[model samples]
Target: MNDKQVMVKMVFDRWYALLKNCDTLLNSLTDEQLLREIAPGKNRGIYLLGHLIAVHDDMLPILGLGDKQHAELFEMFLKSPDSKSTEGIPSVGELRSHWSKQNVMLKEKFDGLTADDWFGKHNSVSAEDFIKEPHRNKLNIILTRTTHLAYHHGQLMLIKQ
Candidate 1:
């Protein structure tokens, strides 16, 4: 392979690593702890888990993997009055299953893309409202999203620590 192939492989690898780290972090918390609100004003693990899933679910349409049927599910999360309401928060097992399924779906989407597809322009209206970036070459966007997730995950972990 050439430089481009190498770069894409690296991006995919890094994405996998990030996702694994996210899963590990989430798995570390007990069900009760996952539901506990660590800080008075902070979101609990359940809220963060739901938010992460919602974000990924929102990305599905932008990635062209499916229709926008789940868009409202994520929208509800972003527009919800309180993150701690537990109205839509899944159980720990349910969250774990959801995470696994979404992870697989995202990986499939990434793997199915051609070199040009990664750099092509795609419009994504997820929790962030509006986002447009090169779909074929999305290393920067992946890094940015991963960083955001890590930051929030760190905050959640610190609260428990």
Candidate 2:
């Protein structure tokens, strides 16, 4: 395969694997379990899940995929610190549904990109800069988000016990 094709495959594989692992861990939890905090003041499982959903939803714009599908999520999850407030934040079931839909939409958009588009400019990278540093292309976003997922996935594990 060409370099762009290979890069896309690798990035997608790793991203999918990490997402699956996170989903499995998340699905195993009860709604009440998701509300429990990892520590006294730290984020709860539900909060983290909403944060992840909002972050991933934002990725649509950041990756030049499209406008965000859930703009309200940014305020509810990203704009504030972890809250048990539940005033605006979605419930566990709602967040789970949002998470699934956002990911599926992301995957669909990702699949539509041409091989060359993978090496094209992303959110911040200028055309010149992208050519100079191809590693900063769209695929790198997946790598960055993969690490982010792993970080929160570790936190999600703490809610289990």
Candidate 3:
């Protein structure tokens, strides 16, 4: 395989591992535990799952994959006096199913892109500012995004205390 393909494969493997870890961690939480806030101002397991899904949903489009827009998913996690309760937090089973679907969609989207397509420049806004940057390649974007998710996952693990 070419270097680009090899790189994509590596990113894909890491993404798969992240998903597996999330599934395992989530599976260990009881419904009551998932809904219980570990501490004041801290997100519950359900909220974390929603946030994770939101991150992937928001970023996938930037990688050139047109999928469902779930921006509101993240908004629900934000602290607001008017914010709704975690009652809407899907069950671990439901989150797993959704995660699996998204995983498949991600793999298909990544697999369909050509090496040139992966490296093509697209106008992408940075998270901190509106400045545009060329998203080097889907593999690069995926790697960065995976790191972000993994970081959050680590935070989620700390909630077990």
Q: Candidate 3's C-alpha lDDT?
A: 0.67
For model 1, how does the per-residue alpha-carbon lDDT over 77-144 read when each residue is reduced to its tens digit?
55563467667555767776887887887787778877656655455434343334223334445656
- List runs of model 1 lying over 4 Å from the truth: 68-72, 125-140
lDDT for model 1 comes to 0.67
Best by TM-score: 2
Off by over 4 Å in 3: 38-40, 69-71, 78-84, 87-94, 123-135
Q: Which ten-residue region of model 2 has the weakest summed lDDT?
A: 82-91
Choose the strongest candidate by lDDT: 2
**Per-prediction TM-score to the true structure, in the order listed:** 0.79, 0.92, 0.75
lDDT of 1 at 115: 61
Which 10 consecutive residues of model 3 have the lowest summed lDDT? Answer: 77-86
Candidate 2's C-alpha runs over 4 A off are: none
lDDT of 2 by residue, 1-161 (tens): 98778878888888999989988998899999999998788999889999899888887887888898889888878888986776667888998898888888888998898878876778977888878888897777778889999999999999999
Q: Each candidate: how many clashes?
A: 7, 0, 0
lDDT of 3 by residue, 18-88 (tens): 88897787777676666666567776667667767777876667776785556556566444321337465
Error of 1 at 26 (Å): 1.4
TM-score of model 1 vs. true structure: 0.79
